[model samples]
Target: MSMVINKQLPLPVLLKEEYPLPPWAAQAKVRRDEEIRKIFTGESDKFIVLIGPCSADNEDAVCDYVSRLAKLGEQLSQRLMLIPRIYTNKPRTTGEGYKGMLHQPEPDKAPDLLAGITAIRKMHIRAIVETGLTAADEMLYPENRSYLDDLLSYEAVGARSVEDQQHRLTASSLDIPVGMKNPTSGDFSVMLNSVTAAQHPHNFIYRGNDVTTSGNPLAHVILRGGVDKYGACMPNYHYEDLVRLLEMYEKRPLENPAAIIDVNHSNSNKQHKEQIRIVSEVLHSRNYNPKLKKLIKGVMVESYLEEGCQTIGGEHIYGKSITDPCLGWEDTQRLLYKIAENC
Candidate 1:
């Protein structure tokens, strides 16, 4: 004879959905799809600029910044395609600091993840509907993609997670253009692998169920520099390096031949001011290298209303970053004009 033991089920918790997008979100999505199609079809030669704060912690600040960017985007529509980075989540190196608006809406208080996630989604939707400008964000959590997948024009798989199979698979199914950064060690092989993985169809388990992907044909590469024991930035947008990388990319068939150069992070050696100088350098080099020029599409910069960064758990200064230091609005504007003139 056998005896059975019963376990009690957990109690249900009712949470409010605090953030929801307005009706205009649908129209914005349609425009974004048209823009993406133009980019991939060679109908648009405009440089795609992904610019914004290191992390979007405040909704009002981000909205103000995007409003300004959208106006400038309209003024420079012929030369550049602006995609404001509305990144609401941050991936940590050691699992410390405020992760993003999705984890702590109040900052340093009890976590209200339900509210945080909703807040982020609502903000993303607002960026598109209110400004009529496309948005870009780093996809950290695979499950979170569904929340804003319909609103984003572009997505980035950061250096830290580019090598992960799950992330690569997730990229395959993404509806918008995806950019995969090279590994932290500055190796291009991982990114190449990522591009290959994202270009082909994939089948995987998702949300406790089986799913298949038709692959993201618009997937591309982002050179954000890399680090090693010597702590130097890898592939410094040099003529030789860009030539070699493009050769490799051409030798093997890829979903897309274009690449986005990130002017921040290891590329600028983490110096906020260096972003402008690096952009100028790349533009100059691209002028002489035809092959490199053809493969290069645009650039990425981390900028905010103010320059530099702040302590995450410390007093809130507002408009500054809690992670990496960013270029101020004035400098960011100057850089944009310079790229337009040079490119």
Candidate 2:
């Protein structure tokens, strides 16, 4: 064989068996799950906010961030349903750079799949137990999702992988809310088609077994903006763009015609500081139009204990981002309070 077959890590079942959630944590998860699902089903008028670092690079920092968010969530429970983002797997555009904690638990160390897996699981469990918060992680590797699916409350299919057959199929099987982002080309049809595929039943081979899924009704869309032919970012989270998406959704049969705007990606042209302005503009649009508010369920923000980003292996800041620039804790806190007031 050309590639080496490394030793296999424990399966998701065995891992959970060994480190199962406590009864209290499990009950908390159930309550949080329903609360989040209600937003997708339109049963709850509260807006959902998925905010955290771009990737969970450090367990201590990530846990601390979620702990603070958990406190804020309690106070804003009536207006906002905050789900901390614990994205462990990052998709590199050219298959390079730090591929998140799942690839290398330590930023300076070499890749260790086994250790990475254990670290991610432990980090997620700790967040829930320590803060009573359920998180949202990207489904970067469909097969790897099984490792964390039981613990995640929300999932996202990144723009690069939205059209993949395996990703769509795996999303179909998930019971929780899954957000499918528009491709880099900004093709809404491709994203909507993925949603359609996810919201209908399908049978596919998975993990050496034939698995059939009844389909996930909560699968929805995420607008992360797009890149132009000249490689410039073209945002699609504007009022007109949202109206266009609403028209498209009206034609589709997807159960929950909703979208969550990603404020830090191409939408803000990767300018992390633009996140605050973007949120304010989107909120203004929601306030101006009733239909738009009904279609936009939430916003996804990249934030951490510190602002901006640093190259990996450099003099790293304690809570700054390693993958992308993010909003600092103070600004993030101010923005959250503002959003609550608007809500």
Best by TM-score: 2
Candidate No. with top lDDT: 2
Report the C-alpha displacement of residue 92, candidate 2, in angstroms.
0.3
Backbone clashes under 3 angstroms, per model? 0, 0
lDDT of candidate 1 over 248-290, digit per residue (tens) = 8978888568888998888888898988888888887788887
Q: What TM-score should be assigned to candidate 2? A: 0.99
Worst 10 residues of 1 by lDDT: 8-17
Clashing pairs in 1: none
Q: What is the C-alpha lDDT profile of model 2 across 104-203, one tens digit per residue? A: 9998899998899889999999999999998999999999988887799999999999999999999999989999999999999999999999999999
Per-model TM values vs. the true structure: 0.91, 0.99
Could you tell me how far off, in angstroms, the CA of residue 52 lies in candidate 1 after the best superposition?
0.3
- The C-alpha stretches of model 2 lying farther than 4 A from their native spots are none
User: What lDDT score belongs to each candidate, Candidate 1 first?
Assistant: 0.82, 0.93
**Alpha-carbon RMSD, each predicted model:** 4.6, 0.8
